[model samples]
Target: MRYFSPSKAVILLLLTVCCYCTSFSQTEKKHDVIVKLNGDQLNGDVLEISDSTIRFTYTGEKLIYNIKKSEILKITFASGRVETFNAPPATAQTTPVTATGASTAERRNKVAVLPFTFVKDGQNAAQEVSDEIQNELYALLSKHSGVYTVVSPRATNVLLTKAGITKANMLNYSMAEICQVLGVEFIVDGMVTQNRTTQTSYGNTSYSDKTKKNDNSDDKKSSGSASTSSTSVQNYETTMDMKIYNDKSEIVYNQNRKAFWNTADAYKNTMEYLVKRCPLYKK
Candidate 1:
């Protein structure tokens, strides 16, 4: 081997150091992923993890972010390690109501029907009727197979009640909150209106005065008169307004339809029409 000069030795050392540094840097590179409760994934490095928050930085960014632990579903490390986090309990105060509600991962193809708002004679009807309509709608929806999974009206009502939600105050909360509480991908809200539009009265009168044969004698000559009978019929016009919302709290369907026939229970027909035409209805 030939001996190298001072300058050549210095250059060789520098090259070796540079190659080692590059290899070390390559080996040190790491990527950590954060999965949010809303099913959003973030590719970044977890700088620090605390009891309530996590310090993170984007894949190529230098700035750090503090994310709430409650919002994170899991953290996957580049070393093939996964750490999971529990979702916080849902509560009116603790649970956040965003436009998209909770995680969108498992909510697909599920539906919930809420108690309908019933109006009769231009005034609010009884709650029982509203519940009746809800149950009826639920039954109709349950009949269709391979369309979607429908939550029972009883379960939906119980969840709403446990959350202190009622038709009277349902508007106070956003649709996303209700969707999260119900754990469904879609929500069905509706209103039924019935009004008496007309009344018809009909009557008929008959009289018989005839000379009968010997058997009946002159009894018919006495002239017996038949009483008049009258009947009153009330006609009602029924209309139904239906609205469907997705987990994102966006209104996907809004329609109002009136029944072809004016009857007390015409709302049933209108509701059926709307459901058949709704976007969620597969066939």
Candidate 2:
């Protein structure tokens, strides 16, 4: 039989653990990663590259993610392959310098809120609501100083008119083209739907009461009552669906939210919620 000292046994155990850790680390590093310009790294295995886009399935996942070349900084592969990207210089300034020689304080993630499409019984009301929502979005986003740069409704309308894009044909154009024409890094487009409803209800109640007079006479009475009523009014239910796309035309956010209130409140509440929930809010 062989006997080993305690110190020797402990040394052997540590050596074994070191070797195991090295092996595990090598195994974990066997994948590719896409590093974005903003310093975000997406770990995955490169699946395909086509049309200035890289498509890949994230490590240990089946879902695929596609990234535009313009947005990527570099790509590192498991097999020790490395590729660095150099984005071309911008031809035009996204946010032009001001008279004071100070650049706009807004982040690079500029956005354009296009006119909303409305679904309502009255055409005038629908137009008014759409205009109201656009104005509300501009007001809310602009107040969040430095968080986002929202294009003014007037500027957006002018661009749309120049592009010959009316409410009826706005959907026909592609998101990428819209982004280009707007000179923005992102596009915010959505639809507003209004639903009106009338409801009626009825109720019945029965009770019995007994009274005693001072002369020791007792009186009892039973009564039953039933009532029915009807009400009719226009109750506006607003459903707003918003979509945000990047300069590459990739969908960054697509959310649907609903609110029941007057036109102004509906726009205010829904837009506030969506803006806060948006990933771009704090980015």
Predicted structure with the largest TM-score when compared to the true one: 1
Best by lDDT: 1
Error of 1 at 54 (Å): 49
> TM-score, each model?
0.59, 0.47
> Per-residue alpha-carbon lDDT of model 2 for 1-283, expressed as tens digits?
9998999999999999999999898777578888888879888799988878989898779998778988888888887888888563454323322121222233256788877777764443556667777887777767773656788989877877766666766556667666777777778778776666553344545454544445454655445545555554455667778888876779999999888464534756787888877766652
Q: Clashing pairs in model 1?
A: none
Estimate the lDDT of model 2. 0.72
Q: What are the per-model C-alpha RMSD values against the true structure?
A: 15.5, 23.0
Off by over 4 Å in 1: 1-103, 204-212, 215-224
lDDT against the true structure, each candidate: 0.86, 0.72
For residues 90-188, could you state the per-residue lDDT of candidate 1 as single tens digits? Answer: 555442333324467667888999999999998999889999999999988778735689999998888887777877767778888889888889999
